[model samples]
Target chain A: MNRSILLQSRPVGMPGPENFEFREGSVQEPQEGQAVIRTLYLSVDPYMRGRMSDAKSYVEPFKLNEVISGGIVGEVVESKSGDLQPGDKVIGMLGWRLYNTVDAGSVRKLDPSIAPLSAYLSVLGLTGLTAYFGLLDIGKPKAGETVVVSGAAGSVGMFVGQIAKIQGTRVVGIAGTDEKCEYLTRELGFDAAVNYKADNFQEELAAACPNGVDVYFDNVGGSVSDAVMNLLNDYARIPLCGAISSYNSTEDVGPRILSKLIKTRSMIKGFVLSDYASRQAEGMQQLGQWLAEGKLKYEETIVEGFDHVVDAFLQLFQGTNLGKMLVKVSDPQA
Target chain B: MNRSILLQSRPVGMPGPENFEFREGSVQEPQEGQAVIRTLYLSVDPYMRGRMSDAKSYVEPFKLNEVISGGIVGEVVESKSGDLQPGDKVIGMLGWRLYNTVDAGSVRKLDPSIAPLSAYLSVLGLTGLTAYFGLLDIGKPKAGETVVVSGAAGSVGMFVGQIAKIQGTRVVGIAGTDEKCEYLTRELGFDAAVNYKADNFQEELAAACPNGVDVYFDNVGGSVSDAVMNLLNDYARIPLCGAISSYNSTEDVGPRILSKLIKTRSMIKGFVLSDYASRQAEGMQQLGQWLAEGKLKYEETIVEGFDHVVDAFLQLFQGTNLGKMLVKVSDPQA
Candidate 1:
C-alpha cells in the first residue's frame, strides 16, 4: 500500500493543513514502457497555492479527489521498460505520493554522483531555469545596471541575484527576516539586502540602490513591489515571477503604483516556469556549468516526514521557510 | 504686439480658463541665428493634461507662469539665419503665442505646397509620430492578428486602429458615443467599433472582437482598460499611450484588473512620444507617405482663438473631441 494526500476542497484565504487529506491506496504494478518510482522528496512552492483555487488560471485547478502534483525526485524501484532498471534515480513532475507508476518517458534519470539528487529539485531544476529565463530573457539586465529582486533568500530569488551579479550588475535583494537578509548578502553575494519587515524598508531600499533599479525580479508582490516601482529608472523592466504576498489573501487587491509603470516607461511581464519548458535543456546546460563553477549556491528547508507535506506548504505563506521548501516523503532507498 | 496665453497656475485637476491668462506682448525682431515666426496652429493633446499638474512624470511638468508648449505650425515672418527665409512655413515646439522668436535649428521648415500648413501640426507632426511608434515599435502587431484601441475616435487612437488595419489586422475600436463608433467603423475602415456608453459594454466588446485581442493601444486607461485586459490573448502586448480617464480624478483609484496581467502573461509598456525622439524623422516620413497616398486619414477639431486654448485642452478629458484637437492661433496665410 502507498500513501498520498488529496485535495479536499478549494480554499478562500490561507489554506489550512486540513484542506488536504492523506489517503492510502494499493500501488499499481508497472505496465509495459512504465517504471515505478519510490517517492524521495516533494517540492512545496508558492505557485502550488494557485492550483488549489477554483479560479481561472494558467493551469487547471486541482480536482477535489485528485493528488496535488508538482516537481519530485525519486528512485526507480522497478521497471517494465528497457530504458530504465531498478536503483535508477530520476526527477520529474510527480505528485505527493509514496510510490508513482508513470510512463518511462515522463521521467529523466538523475546521476546521483554528478550532484545531490535534491539539487535536481533546487538549483538544477525548475528553480534555476526560472531565474535564468526570467532575469535574462525578460529583465535583460545590462552591465553596470542595478537589478532588484524580491524574496531574495528563497530558491529562485537567490539564483536571480547571483546571476545578475555574474553579469556585472549591482544586485539588491528584499527578504523577510534579518537572518535571511544576512545570508543573501554574505553567502549569496547580493550587493545589498533589505529586510522588508523593517520599519524603514523603503528608505533602506533607496539607500542601498542609489542608481535606481533597471530590472526588478518580482517574487513577493504587494507593498514591496509598490516601493520598488517608485525607485525604478526610466525604461526599466519587471519580470513577474510570483505574488506570494497576495496568494493567501481572500480578496484580490491588485499591485499598487501600477500608474508608475506608465510614467517610467517601464514594462511588467508575468511568466510561468512552464512557459519555458521547451528550452529547459538549454537552461540546464548553463545552470549545470554555473553550479560546477560554484558560481551559484542553493539551500533547502526540508521537512522530515510525508505527513508534514501540508505543513510545509502552509509555512510558505507565513514566510517560515528559507530557500526551496521540500518534504522528505520516504527513506531515500525505500 | 502679439497675444499669448501664459500658464497662470499649476492646476489640481481640470484646468479652467482662469488658469490661463491671456497677455499682449511685443514680437521681437530675429537676432543672429534666430527666426521670427507667426504661429498658424497649435496641438492640444491629452498628454498636456499631465503637464498641467505639478507631479513628477516622464516629462517635466509645465512651469507656472510660462507658456504651455507643444507642437506648432507657423510661417517665418522674418529670418536672421541661413536655414530659413521670410514666408517659409515651419513646424516646431513653439508655445501658445501668436508670434515667437526661435533658434533656426529648433524648427523644421515645411513646404506648404506639398501639404496644407495645418497638416504639419496634425498627420505630419508629433501626433502622427506617436501613433507610428506606439503601434509598430511597441505593439509589434503581426498580420491577421486582432488589435483593440481605446479612445479610438481621438487623435493617436484613430491612427493606431487605422495603422493596424493597414497591416492586414482586424481592428476594433472603443469610442464614447454611437456616432463616434459609426465614424470609426464606417469612415476610418476599422473592422468593428463599440460605444463604451452601451449598457452591456463587456458583451459589446466581446461581440465586436470575436477573436481575442493581440495588441491593445491604451489611451483611456480606467474601466475601459480593465475591460480590455480581460480579453487579452496569451502573449498579448499593450502599448500604454495615455490614460485620459485618470487624468482628472482627485483620488487614486487605478485599474482593477491588474491580476489579469499576470494570468494572461500580457505585457503593458508605457511610452511617451519624446522617448522615441531619435527616430522621429523616420516615423514622420513613413506616416507622411501614408497620408500622401490617401491610405491614411486624419481629422482635426479646430478651436479658433489662442485665448480658448485651455477650453480645447479641457474638451479632451470630457470625451467631446472627435479627432486631433488643435487651436488655430492665427489666420492662415492667403
Candidate 2:
C-alpha cells in the first residue's frame, strides 16, 4: 500500500496539518517507459506555502484531492524502462507519496558512492542551485564586497553565505536565534552573523557590516529586508530569492525601502530556480565539487514519518528548521 | 547693472512669484582667473523644483537667500584668465542672474557656428546628456525593441525617443496635450504618442504598443508610470530620469507596479546626470554630432524675463511647457 497526502482545502494564513489528508492506496504496476520508486526523502520549501493558497501566483495552487509535487530523492523499486534498474537511486520532481510511478525521462540517476542519497535533496539539489545562480547571476558579488543574507540558517541562505565566502567577499548573515547565528558563523564559515530577534538588530547589522552591504541575498522580506536596505551601498545588487515573511500575510505589505533603491541605484531582482533549468547540470557539477572538497557543509532537520510531512512543511514558517527541512518517508534498504 | 532672483522661502507645492525676490546689483569686474559672462538662456527643469524644497535629495536643496543655479548659455564680455577671450560663447552652471563672474575652468567654450548658442542649453547640454546616458546606459534599448517615454515633449524625453529610433527600435511617447503629442509623433518621428489627459489613456497606450514595452524612460512617476509598467515585457529596463508627477506631492506616492519588477526581471534605475560627470564630455560630443546632423530636433519654451523664472519653473509641474523650459534672462549682444 502507498500513502499520499492530498490537498483537502486552501490555507488563508499559515497552513495547518488539517489542510492535507493522508490516504492509503494500492501501488499500480509501472507501464512501459516508466519506473516505480519508493520515496526516501521529500524536500519542503518556503515557496510551497505560496502554492497552498488559492491566490494567483507564479505557479498554480494545488488542486483539491491531488498530491502536492516537489523535489524528491528516492530509490527505484521496479523499472519498465531500460534506462533504470531495480534498486537504483534517483532524484527528480516527485510528489509527496510513499511510492510513485513516473516517466523514466522525468528522473535522473544519482551516484550514491559520491555522497549520501539525501545530499541530492540538499547541497546537490534545488537549494544549492538557487544559491549559485541567485548570487552569481543577480547578486554579482565582487572580491572584497560585503554580502548580507537573511534567513542565514535555512537551506538556501546557508549556501548563499558560503558561496560569497568562496568568492572572497565578506559574508554577514541574519538568523532568528543565537544558536542559529552561532551555527552560521562557526559551522558555515560566515564572517559574521546577527540574531534578528535581538533588541538591537539594526545596530548589530550595521556594526557587523561597517562598510555597507554591496549585495543582499534577501530570503526573508519585511522588517529584516528593510533594515538591510538601509545599509546598502551605492550600486548594490539584491537577488530577491524569497520573501517568506510576507508570504503568509493576507494583505499586501510590500518592502518599505523601495525609494532607497532609487537613491542608491540598487536593484532587487526576484528569481526562480526553474528559470535556470538549462544551467542545472553546470551548477550541480560545481556544487558537487565544492561538497567533495569539504568547503560546503549541509544540515537537514528530518521528520521521521510519512504522516508528519505536513508538520515538516509548517515548521518552515515558524523558523523551526535548522537547515533544509526534509521528511524521511522510509529507511534505505540495505 | 545685473538683476538676479534669489531664493526667499521654500514653498509647500508650487513656488509662486512671491517665493523669489529679484535684486538689482552692479556687475562686478572679473578678478584674476575669472571671466564675466552675460547670460542669454537659463534652463528651467523639474529637478530645480526639488532644489527649492528643504527635503534631502540626490542634489542639495537651494538655501534661502542664495541664488538658484542651473545650466546657462552666455557670451563672455571680459576675461581675466588667458583661457577665454571677449566675445567667446560659453556654457556653464550659472544662476538666474543676467551677468556674473566665474572661474574660466568652470565654463566650457562653445562654438556658436556649429549650432545656435541656445542649443548649448538644450540639446547639447545637461538635458541632452541626461537622455543619452539614461536611455542608452540604463535603458539598454536593443534594435527592434519597443521603447516608451513619459513626458515625451519634455527635454530628456525628446532625446530618449530620438536615440531609441536611432537604435532601430519602435518608439512611443506620452505627453499632456494634443499639440505636444502631435509634435512628438510628427516632428520628432516617434511611432506613437499618448495624451495622458485623454480618457482612454490605458486603451490608447495598449493599442500604440502592440509589441509590448521593452524600455520605459520614466520621466513622470505616478499613475502614468504604473500603467506603462503593467504593459512591460519581461526583462524590460526602466531608466528613471525624473518623477515630476510626484515632485509636488504633499504626501508620499510612488509608482504602484514595484512588484511587477520582480515578476518580469525588469530593472528601474534612478540616475542623476551629474553622477556621470566623468563621461560628460563623451556624451556632449555624441549629442553635438547628432544635433549637427539634423538627426535630433529640440524645442525650447523660453519665458521672457528673469523675473518670470519662478513662474517658468512652476509651469513645469503643471505641464505647461511643451519642450525644454528656459528663461531668457537678457537679449543677445549683437
Candidate 3:
C-alpha cells in the first residue's frame, strides 16, 4: 500500500496541517522502461510555500486533492529497465508517497559511495545549487567585501554565507534566535551573526558591517530586507533568493527603496535555481570538492517518519530548524 | 558686475524662490590659464533636487550662502590662455552667474556648426547620453519587446522612448497630462502614451501594452511605478534612472514588489550617467549620428533671464515642462 499526502485545500495565510490530507492506495506495477521505488528521504523547502497559494509564480500552484510533488530520494525495488538494477538508488521530483512507480529515465541514479544518499536531498542538491548560482553569478562577492544574508540559519542562507566566505568576503548573518546566530558564527565561521528579534538589531547590524554591505543575499524579505538596505554601499549587489517572511503575509508593504538605490547606484536581482539549469553539474562538482576537502560543512535537521512530513514543513515558518530540514521516511535497502 | 544666485537656505520639503538670493560682485580678471565667460544657457534638472537637500548624494549638496553651480553653456569674453580665445563658445559645469572667470581647461570648446550652443545643455549633452546608456546598457531592450517609460515627456524620458523605438521595440509613455500624452504619441512617434493622472490610468496603461512590459525605464518612483510594476514580463529589466516623485518627500513608503521580481526572475538597477563616464564618447557619437539622420528630435522650455532660473527649476516639480528646462541668461555674441 502506498501512503501519500495531497493538498486538501489552498492555504489562506499561514498553512496548517488541515490543508493536507493522507490517503492509502496500492502501488502500480512497473511496465517496460519503468521502476518501482521505495521512498527514503524528502526535502521540505520554504519555496514550497509559494506553490500552496493560488497565484501566478515561477512554478504552478498545487491543485486541490492532488498529491504534493517535490524533491525526493528513493531506492529502486522493482525495475524492468535494462539501465537500472533493483538495488540502485535514485533521485527525482516525485509525489509525497511511500512508493513511486515512475519511468526509469525520470530519475537520476545516485552513488552512495561518493556521499551520503541524504546529501543529495540537502547540501548537494537544490539548496546548494541555489546558493552557488545566486551568490557567485548575481551577488559577485569580492575579497574584503561584506556579504550579509538574511535567514542565516535556513538551508539556502547557510550555504550562501559559507560560499561567500570561500570567496574571501566578510560574511554577516541575520537569524531569529541567539542559538542560530551563535551557530552561524561559531560553527559555520561567519564573521558575525545578529538576531533580528533583538531590540537593537538595526544598530548591531550596522556595527557588524562597519564597511557597509557590498553583497546582500536575501532569503527572508520584508522588514529584515528594509534594515539591510539602509547599509548598502555604493555599487552593492543583492540577489533575491527567497522571501519567506512575506510568503505568509497578505499585504506586502514597506519603505520605498528606489531613492536609496539611485543614490548609491546599487542593483538587486531576483532568481531561482531553474535559471541555472545547465550549470547544475558544475555547482554539484564544486560543492562535492569543498565537502571532501573539509573546506565546506553542512548541517541537517531530520524528522523521522512520513507521518511527520506536514509538521516538518510547517516548522519552516516558525524558524525552529537549525539547518536544512528533511523527512527521513525509511533507510535505503539497496 | 557679475550677478549670481546663491543658496540662501535649505528647503524643508519642496524648494521655493525664498530659498535663493541674488548677489552682485565685480567679475574677476582672467589669470594666465583663465578666461572670462558670459553665461548663455543654464540647465535645470530634476536630479538637482537631490543636491538641494543637505544629504549625501552623488554630488555635493548646495551649501548655504554659497553660489550654486550646474551645467552651463557660455561664450568667452576675455582669454589669457592659448587653449581658449575670445568669442569662442564653451560648455562646462559652472556657477549660476552672469559672468564666470574659470580656468580654460575646465571648459570644453563647442563648435556652433555641429549643434546650437543651447543643445549642449539638452539633446547632445548629459540628457541624451543618460537616455542612451540607461536604456541600451542596463534596460537591454530587444526587438519586438515592449518598453515602457515614465516621465515620458521629460528630457531624458523623451530620448529613452526614441532610442527604444530605434531598437525596434514597441514604446509606451506615461506622463501627467493629456496634452503631454498626445505630444508623445503624435509628435514623438511613441506607440502609445497614457496620462497617469486619469482615473483609468492603470487600465489605459494595461490596454497599451498587450504583450507586457519587457523593459521599464523608471524616472518617477511613486504610485506611478507601482502601477507599471504589476505588468512586467518574465526576465524584465528596470533601469532606475530617477525618483522625482520621492525626491522632496520626507518619507518614502510604497507597496513592496520583491515577490513579483522573484516570480518573473527580473532585475532592477539604479544608475547615474557618471557610472558610464568611460563610455560617454560612444553614447555621444551614437546620439549625434541619430540627430544628423533626422531620426531623433528634442524640445526645450527656455525661461528668459537669470531671475526666472529658480522659478524654472521649481516648475519641474509641478510637471509643467514638456522637455528639458533651461534658463536663457543671454545670447552668445560669438
Top of the candidates by lDDT = 3
lDDT of 1 by residue, B179-211 (tens): 999999899999999988889998999887788
Note the residue pairs that clash in candidate 1.
Answer: none
> For residues A1-334, could you state the per-residue lDDT of candidate 1 as single tens digits?
9988999988888899779999999898989999999999889888888899887778788999899898999998999999888888889888788899999999999988778888999889989999999999999999999999999988899999999999999999999999999999998899999999899999999999999999999998778887888799999999988888777775555443445777788998888888898999899999999989999889999998888889988998888778888888776663
DockQ of each: 0.52, 0.32, 0.85
Q: TM-score for model 2?
A: 0.87
lDDT of each: 0.86, 0.86, 0.93
B330 in model 3: Cα distance from truth in Å? Answer: 0.2
DockQ order of candidates, top first: 3, 1, 2
Candidate 3 structure quality by residue, lDDT tens digits, A1-334: 8899999999988999999999999999999999998999999999898999888789999899999999999999999998789889999999999999999999999989988988898789999899999999999999999999999988988999999999999999999999999999999999999999999999999999999999999998899999999999999999999989889989889999888889888999999999999999999999999989887788899999999999999999999998899999999775
- Compare the candidates by DockQ and give the number of the best one: 3
Model 3 residue B232 distance off true place after TM-score fit, in angstroms = 1.0
Question: Which residue pairs overlap in candidate 3's backbone?
Answer: none
Query: lDDT tens digits, residues A1-334, model 2?
Result: 9888889888888788889999898887899999999999999999888788875456678888899998899989989999998888999888789999999999999889999888888888888899999999999999999999999999999999999999999999999999999999889899999999999999999999999999999888777877887788888898878888877775444333434565566776777887898999899999999998988999989999887898889989999789899988887783
lDDT of 3 by residue, B1-334 (tens): 8899999988888999999999999999989999999999999999988887988777789888999999999999999999998999999999999999999999998989988778888888989999999999999999999999999999999999999999999999999999999999999999999999999888999999999999999999999999998999999999999999999899989888888888888999999999899998898889989999998899999999998999999999999998899999998775
List ranges where model 1 is wrong by over 4 Å: A254-258, B255-258
What is the descending lDDT order? Answer: 3, 1, 2
